[model samples]
Target: MVDTNETHVIVGAGLAGAKAAETLRSEGFTGRVILLGDEREKPYERPGLSKKFLTGAEERDALRVHDPSWYTAHEVELHLGQPVTALDREAKEVRLGDGTAIRYQKLLLATGSSPRPLRVPGADLAGVHYLRRLPHAERLRAVLRNLGRENGQLLIVGAGWIGLEVAAAARGYGAEVTVVEPQPTPLYGVLGPELGGFFADLHRDRGVSFQLGASITEVVGQDGMVLAALTDTGEELPAHAMLIGIGAAPDTALAEAAGLEIAPREEGGGVAVDASLRTADPDVFAAGDLASAYHPVFGRRLRVEHWANALNGGPAAARAMLGREVVYDRLPYFFSDQYDLGMEYSGYAAPGEYAQVVIRGDAGKREFIAFWLDGENRVLAGMNVNVWDVTDPIQRLVRSRRPVDPERLADPGVPLDALPG
Candidate 1:
């Protein structure tokens, strides 16, 4: 039943695009599968870049999603270092930077996001860095190693996940780390002040300094190399290197240029798509960080930048493209490992969306599950820190959308599965 004459093209050869190609062939698609990427390297997962890779505990080869031979063996037309420059919707073709126009019967845009650049003075200095690609991590690893030996200081602007993870990695290298954030606490926008304070304390105990409620006004450098960072609070923090980790913005240029509907910034900004991950053009689909997909459960559009989204969304879009019924309602999930603490979070709840955050177990010991609830005590999100095997029940609790007794929800003696959802 496969269409032998059809050709499917996937752009941005990241985790999502690579997986989509694998899924198409695995699902018995005999059509031509072309995967394009701007980077010359093979597809790789990104989570390790900030954790094990940066800490020098993992090798580069471990990051690859598939071996180099896998693509050849699977008959996937792998195209690396070929950036897609333009898309012609009417002609059903994508123009590459090399002037090659590849026609497709179906198209998928898996273009991932890029780190938001720091526009402060001296940002272009040699010692100021940003981590988004494999090369960036490789360079940062070397820089940290050299800085550690010289007893240098690392000034990290932004206390988000990447910044904090890099702080932990820098500390592993014996480098002095100081994190500056405009927010009152680390991870304020995601975990809110309650749990954000926990992270601040956690990092402080690990010999990391914090300049909370502050922003870097300028990057001071000497001889085209970073020397220090000046804060808006009129403080100059001495540093041999600086890292800007504010956040990332989705890559949607190809889809946007092709006249695809894009979501507003307030709606999580990306290429807008329905629950099936299909854009208005029908033949074109968007996935991974580039997709602002309609979530059936949340009743809203969500554009997640986590590794899990790309790991799962690609195959979902592949199946949908193959004419299968698909509904992408996966809960927003993410995990972090900073020092000895490892945590997994499920569901979505912005700061104003939840009325109360109830905790089970001892938060002081970093062994607990925190639940964000609405006024009716309905679970909106749950995060388990240093805990294991509770993701299933926690996801069910959020999906149930039912109220539970706060006291019981916080009781360690009560089984989470036994509780009323």
Candidate 2:
């Protein structure tokens, strides 16, 4: 057990780090808690960036994960804007950017992630942007609004979650938008072709054009401002602004220098941790987007980049640090909102792991729940799109891992809770 006066240092002031600090205090640990962040702002919810926050439906202050008073009242020391520069594992101390060394009894690295940089020729142009931080979202919102006013064209370089949501938001703002994806369908890796194609249709119906199975050779620009993107197919897609939302790379430079185990990049690279969320060094822990923990539920090492994972993993890591027996076994959960569609997914399944997909309600109607099942008829994962109050039942179906009747699973008249075991 950690001594009451022992200082617990948490790196990264995102949701996971904040939640971990909250857990430590709530669990009666009277230790000194220091939360460090490189960002200027305090912990805030990021999911709103692409939807509510960017669309001007939510205020900036409301996006904060916790008010400043909470940290003060809880006696949690927050070091914002100043990033840690070095980790001296031997001395159990971290050096800040200004060369101040702070010692700690235990350390938690939650140094989230940064948006993957676009490598095209004109990617550095003034009008080209990527969404990851509040400032980026704010700038993109302003850009989209300007485009809407002038009826300018908006070009998206990815069809992933950020790309699609921004497309939806841009369309709502009256910008003529075009999304270009190398994949044949949007979200193909996650939802597979059938469902991904449904999303493509959904976007197409909303006046968003897609250049599927297309690759950009270069971003065309003039006066250091992006004007269009040249496709490998010899087509020049005109644009007033471009947003690249391919994906994010885990922020692991600190962990790497400290000699923590790192996972393979293809496997969602991050600091490697055991089932208990502890690194090779017992005094150190990792969580959030930067820690790829061994997931017992999925029976594999998985790194999840979703809000729910960070929310649940933070407390789990904190409990483990306090010498509590903890296994981060929660099924990964994530949700996305696009136009009229809102979706919640639970459980884990690689692209090709689940063979059969059973759907209830009409996909064309945009209100339905779909279940991905393994060969033995066990539900592997499930998602409810534009459906209300069914996530609990869907999650239960995935957790049970029992054979479910395909017919019943696809029948809207049959209740999910009453489905056969």
Candidate 3:
């Protein structure tokens, strides 16, 4: 039976919070649903911030997860620009930044994450940028357009997905981009050294320069405008602007203050939750990037900051909050677009977790499937680059947790489904 008197509050009006509210309504929860956000903008997806929106291929309106009227029509109380400042578990209420307090029977923290800031000198200069919110993207878009016209140089710190995507977007606008990464190769942490060279070459072919195995020590600027970046390798790279894309840390301040358990940094730190997405506090739950949720299949806690995680995690958490069974065993999945290459990676295989990487098709052509396997040749993760309709089989292979012959795994003629999972 639905309790119309009960009120459910969701903090952080990103994709996760928005979807959670929608799910509550769709699941016949005839209760008060309040979605609060720190940003004035309505709930929106982040994937476009680094992709189409950055390149001017898509407008800002297109990034919104739902139309403004949807919230009103669904009776979901949407509060914009009002961040929750405190969570009072005993009182069952959340205090807003303006000192407004709202009571709730249940709470969901979909606070998402923030980009890690560059700690180097002059990092606070006017031209230094980071891509996380809508405002950041707007500023970056303008900067890229202006730089492209002037043929200005853009120095990017870190070679992760955001850095490389921005590199491709800047290149699209004809801006000179130089990526400085401490790792030996681009995407070394995710793809590892085996396939990182492929991404390095992809960016290089399109006029992008890379400062591999080096870190930026200082940002040189005059009059609050960035002029160049000095690397630890003793090389000063010229730049009109700089982008810091090292990584993101979960926004867990509210959860922490409320005494929620947090996972260790090595376990992908965030508010720790069980398989059902419920935190140590039964009435409280965490989802999206703010959640380090226990995965039943993987038998470990994982905090994924991808679009898919927010897209699916939100709904899963909503169901769990409604007392439905939710294991949240969805395999880790993410996709990236850079230049002409589009790729989707499924499953998780951190460095040292997989012993072998098997490739089917041509890596040079960038149309291939790369599989990460354990010592027993069990599929751990698989990435399909410029390949279509293979996600199902790839996910099945990883889920099967069975060993397959390495040679067959690499053979193009061997049907993936035919192989022993």
Candidate 4:
């Protein structure tokens, strides 16, 4: 039960929004927290969509962050399935799709993001699907079961996370998987060129055919169902089911309509927020993948779409909104387990700027620890495949940010601790 006035209205009931609500209450705000969302379901975990859950190892119940009981216990008002269609910054109120307007003292927008659409012809065909929500996974699962037919092909456009992930799942289910990517390396943008090559080798070795440098020209269908995809290279590849994972675009329509200063998407871009995650309006704050805040160590405002970032940034934004200064200066980290290889890495490795790289094991064995050092031999990133020793040393090194002897680092004989103070 909200007080009806002087409430904190939070938009987008995803991980960031939910975490903010929990933090706000935990900080003794004692104020009304109204959570508004467009999705009917609860805030769900998205990481499993490509891994354990996709392989039928985990269930949908595990995707939940906090159940209905958890919110009820917090005394926060959950306005599920209701979206704030328009924002009145001057009045501090938002107009809903139902034509209802609600005012608030503080507004936090955590409108996460959406998968970028494929602009090819016949994209609206029946067999095409995009992975973003639970309903999407449900539909894709049904499509996977369609493999009872021998000639079915799963055409995945774009080599980004979702596409490759779906490819792994589809292939595991015994479907012909073909990944159409415009870039030479699949995870090139995030993992850097050198690491991206390592990822490419992993997928290629698993029987996944990657059509690199191939842009889909059109999706051809017959009788309102997808038949095959036409590429810019004048090749028509046959397919039964298709997935569009080109990339993700921030669901910024609600924010942009709010007259907030939005930094257009580029190499590193998002809705610009100050140190406090507050927009120009001051009272209105934004977080999660929708809002891009300044990174201290990285020295750039990155619009990261990582799952951990959303979970971490949510609490940080809540503290900031509560007039508590919190800095998100952590080294960005992410992991991907495709096939038998387990990869864990972090931070941004500059283009052609690896001053020194130490490889611990043979690449042929698919077991190694690759360390990237900056100009002064300070560990910028630590990567390990089938090796766990890399994690401990890398975490300590990045936090210390001190000097390290290159000769000692290159030599695995010397304990990792023996390299630097």
Q: Write the per-residue lDDT of candidate 2 for residues 94-124, one digit (tens) a residue.
A: 9999988889988999999899888978888
Runs in model 1 with CA error above 4 Å?
A: 1-4
lDDT winner between candidates 2 and 3: 3
- RMSD of every prediction: 1.2, 1.7, 1.2, 2.3
Q: Which candidate comes out best when scored by lDDT?
A: 3
Give each model's whole-structure lDDT: 0.93, 0.90, 0.94, 0.80
Model 3 lDDT tens row, 319-409: 9889998888899999999999999999999887889899999998899999999998999999999998999999999999899999999
Model 1 TM-score on a 0 to 1 scale = 0.98
Check candidate 2 and list the clashing pairs. none
Give candidate 3 regions above 4 Å deviation: 1-4
Model 2 clashes, total count: 0
**Per-model TM-score versus the true fold:** 0.98, 0.97, 0.99, 0.92
Q: Identify the runs in model 4 with alpha carbons over 4 angstroms from their true place.
A: 1-5, 148-151, 264-267, 350-357, 389-392, 399-407
Error of 2 at 180 (Å): 0.8
Compared with the true structure, model 4 gives a TM-score of 0.92
